[model samples]
Target: MKNLLYLVLFLLAFSACNRKASDASYSWASDLHQRLLTDFCLTEAQVKDYIRRYLPDVTDEQMRQWEESGALECMMLDGEKRYFRNAGPNLFRIDSLCREVKLAKEGEQVSTSDRANAENLPEILAATDGRGDSCLAAPKRMRVTYTLTVDTNAVPAGEVVRCWLPYPRTDIPRQQDVKLIATSEPSYTLTSEGTTHSTLYMEKRAVSGEPTVFSETFEYTSYGEWHDIRPSDVLPYDTTTELYRRYTSERDRHIVFSPRLRQLADNLTEGEDNPYLKACRIFRWVNDHFPWASAREYSTIDNIPEYVLDNRHGDCGQVTLLFVTLCRIAGIPAHFQSGFMMQPRAWNLHDWAEVYFEGIGWVPVDQSFGLAPYAEKAGKPYFYLGGIDSWRMVVNQDYGMPLVPEKKYPRSETVDFQRGEVEWTGGNLYFTEWGYHMDIEYLNY
Candidate 1:
């Protein structure tokens, strides 16, 4: 009887251990959710509010689906009530949430905004190109010209004339390679980095015939400052010694903005607690360290140190994420924010980072605004960090998935940019593909 009892007891113990392991597998989700709720006291009804404020229209179902799809690996909510995620993980997570909640507001559908004025179009009288008759016989060199007329009364108050050279059209609509190579005026600035950047992004709508086409031949020259920073120069995670407990802790692979970020505090000597200085250094490091590239799409990569070491490049979202991560690791509190960079006649989506100084609360930082170096070289305008450009317009306040009480739908694994903005009345003018064309025109008399 004693031997039999021992065997039964051992079996029960084994079963309990197995169940614990299974729970651990999915515990990441519950851990994240519980932590956020406990700290923020976020209620079920407040889920939509948090989602709308931070993440836009992302639904609870869409976020789950995205998580299941392996898009977002993890998510973290900060002390300031803001949620964050890595690139791939966050994308899928949002998609899942959208699917789960039937009424989950994914984002405010901006379809009823003002329509793009059809009358405010550039008049193209004719476009002509000089090239050999046949493809083979075509001259190695090509010159193209366009004649345009401007609407006197339709001009935007602060608008300046920019150029859009033609690019070869292709079947792939999502391709970003299509751009204007030539313009009526020298509206673009060439950087030493070999990237031809233009502050003026043009949106074109055909008023008459199909847009003209052109090709490339030789290189154009522009005297501009260029930089070739390597992975080591920008990624300095291994260089710091202030914080290691957060990273080395054996509790769980996932962590919030505690020891990991708080570690950065050690690096500062005594008065380094000044939030303003910390923010400045963090901004400089991000802008200087991470090269601008849309390398990682919408998935999550929150571990800034790991991300900078593994991938030398990241876009605005990742860069801002890294900035926030480092700030948290260093003990400073930070959050994520996003919006559109609004120009005179157009709007482009933009994202930036925010940090809480002891007295200031939350301040904004955007490294993707060409950083300080990129700005100095261009010689056209302002520096990033501390000062944000007037062009920036905030739309979403959250980072990761929306807060959902129950799993309504699967979350999206990838982040998506809604092409057009509309209001309640339907101001949808989003083209499946965007194009630009500009010609030198005299002001209408």
Candidate 2:
């Protein structure tokens, strides 16, 4: 009887373990949710009050229903109620909740673009040269500088502050003539460590009460490139090769495949055979489908691709990641390349993917830009698939890879690396604690 009981208990435990593995529910989700309730709780009244104060149209009845259903939870950070753009996770039918509450409350669709498309876009298209096989355009080269600064008063006094500022990638072909002109603190600067993402490291000790600043001034010539690719010319890469196998496989947390995703891919590419054609189909579907919305921090979301599909709206990183995942699912190689994008008189951090065509090499694909109202013209629609504007400042070749020195605390942005990361002996500094600035001057060589 004792032996039989032991076998039963062991079998039950094994089944539970298998169940978790089968579903691919992140182990961290439950714990993070619990923290939301226990450590980060805001009382029901507090939530209602906040809504009344900021969102006057939201009703007591509607708010009450959402709370009772566990679809809404107020996030508290540093003893203050912090607002995240979306409800972290819906305990019920999240997709439905988003459509009714989030979208309905807004009264219109999400913002696709706040500005016109690049003014020089016509020139880019005009510059394209069909060199026998593919279209190639050379973006005018310019020297540019980037700077990132942090406030000393934000962090506690007497602790040492270390920062990792993103440096322009030298490995890629487009940018060249790299130069490091200066740093705020000259004595403690480090550069060019061998890592997938390049960084210019700098550090300074907090002086009783003073701001800490870090900056890197560099010049690199920029070029725009596109290869006119045909499906027949894109020969299949050797999938058995280790590099192909690694990139083609699922990545942790953000890039997993599920039944829903597979079904969506299958539905989109029902009759498509060529990988490039399949990619084009998925790209068009995503661009037409999703709109841009303020997103919850990447740390709070699990599967970005699935999240985009569920919400029907996502920011640049979210949409680009979705495109990349779908392409990989179709057996085409794709990865992330992102940093800052510069337009005349404007600059903002951005994310986009690069797809590998056997004959054409890796090509840029910005579904967010391609889908925007501005790029909806002849030839411009397909420009991002292979041709990216020279305005792009490519910093990362891939996402979720570690920094050269490694981070002591969980990163400020867990999914993508940008801006920079900072920390001291006490703990990791949040984005609320510091700010960064970049000054770009167009230089003629």
Candidate 3:
């Protein structure tokens, strides 16, 4: 009976001391301290000493107050046996701790020294991690189903999958709208079992180049949206503009505004006087002048005028970026557009650009398709803008994404291969020639 009483007294004393620690005056430290104690069974002295040992610059008084009730979150890890605290908005206490321990931490710090250290820590860690020479661990593969229904039973196998529908990674938004034509079936198979489809993954080894062709057509309202006018209608033309300066400084006088192109402009005056036509003419020039070469990177271009100067090669994406850059310099509004190019051999993703002209509004101009022969074949004086090949499916209408979902892998660039996060390289495969297959059904095709 006496031993039980003594035990109760000990617990009472500990509770009193802790209650004082959690007082409102020191709530910032106390709350977090108590949480840590509950999580990791840490003593107040141990917590204080840990904080002090790591963050010695933090005054003992500040540390004491923080221990009692300052702002910090003590989270229990290791099946609730270990406590962990993280740096929150008020990170001064933690920063002091980090400094004493010589540990680097993140967050905007008032002290520039911490900020400087934080910047280089990632590179150091990445180097250390890379040295371990571990290959990227592949995620668990799960089987998913997609059911595709066509509106008509008798469609050409060649026509079922449009040119631009993303196959392997089908998680891109509005993919079904473009890729899946009107189908007569009620239910479709899909890998993701959610209201909205998740990004899909395909292994390079699984696809054996066997064409999974479906033949059918269906009726549905087109989900395509027109480009905005007004501000979206005008291109940047300020001589002081960076784009204008980049072009003018690099381009030779003869090619800057070529007399031949100017004459070609004169020949087509009926609708050619329009800015849209002028932009098309420029796109034609860029397409014809440069050969399609995948050697250059999509991210950076060394010389804007060099392609025209040397009559050299560039890729679809490069020319698209160049055309947009030149159009912006010429004061014609332009923007980049990208999506899958519907082709049989499983082409990599494609990119094109749009120019907003006053009368014709926004028109699609993809020069990489080689417009001259196509125009001649079609018996048209000029190639069509705003008109796209039925072989393509546009997954996105805008560039430099602002509406991507959370936890996106690969974080999209100006152009993407599949609609979702993917990293595949047989070590040397370029963007233009890769293949994939898909099988999905739709309702009311």
Instruction: Give the winner by lDDT.
Output: 2
lDDT of 3 by residue, 1-445 (tens): 9999999999999867865653424432443344344334443345555555446555657644543442333334434523222322223332344433344544433433223223322322332321112211111121112222222222222322221123222432222322334322233332332212122222222223343222223221211122212333444444575534543332332124444433443443334434554566676777665655432222122343444333244466666656665665555666556654533233345776565554334556576654644344433323324333322344444443322222222222323334333222111111222334333222321
Provide the clash count, candidate 3: 47
Error of 2 at 135 (Å): 5.4
| Candidate 2 per-residue lDDT over residues 1-445, each given as its tens digit | 9999999999999967875664464334553454344434445555555555335566768765665443553455656664333443332223354455545555655332224244455555677652443344445454555555557576667667889888877877776666777767776444453366778877877765677777777777666666556789677788887767777778887778788887887888888778778888988998777765556667767799987876666788999989888877777889878887765566788899888877667777888776544455535567677777767677888888877677766677778878888987555666667788777777741
Alpha-carbon lDDT of model 2: 0.69
Q: What lDDT score belongs to each candidate, Candidate 1 first?
A: 0.37, 0.69, 0.39
lDDT of 2 at 213: 72
- Estimate the TM-score for candidate 3: 0.37
> Per-residue alpha-carbon lDDT of model 1 for 1-445, expressed as tens digits?
9999999999999867865664455444554354343333433335445445545666678556543443332333543433232333233233434324423545432221112211111010011111121101101111213223333322233333222222222221111122344543333332121111112223222233333222121111111111111122222233234333332222211124445345543443235544455555666656665555433324333454445434545666667666666666665555555644433345455667554443223335576664543244433222344334333334334444321121122222123221211111111111212232222221120
Estimated TM-score per prediction? 0.34, 0.76, 0.37
Candidates ranked, most accurate by lDDT first: 2, 3, 1
Q: Which candidate model has the greater TM-score, 2 or 3?
A: 2
Arrange candidates by TM-score, highest first: which order?
A: 2, 3, 1
Candidate 1: stretches off by over 4 Å: 1-271, 300-305, 344-347, 373-383, 403-407, 413-445
Q: RMSDs, each prediction?
A: 26.4, 11.7, 26.0
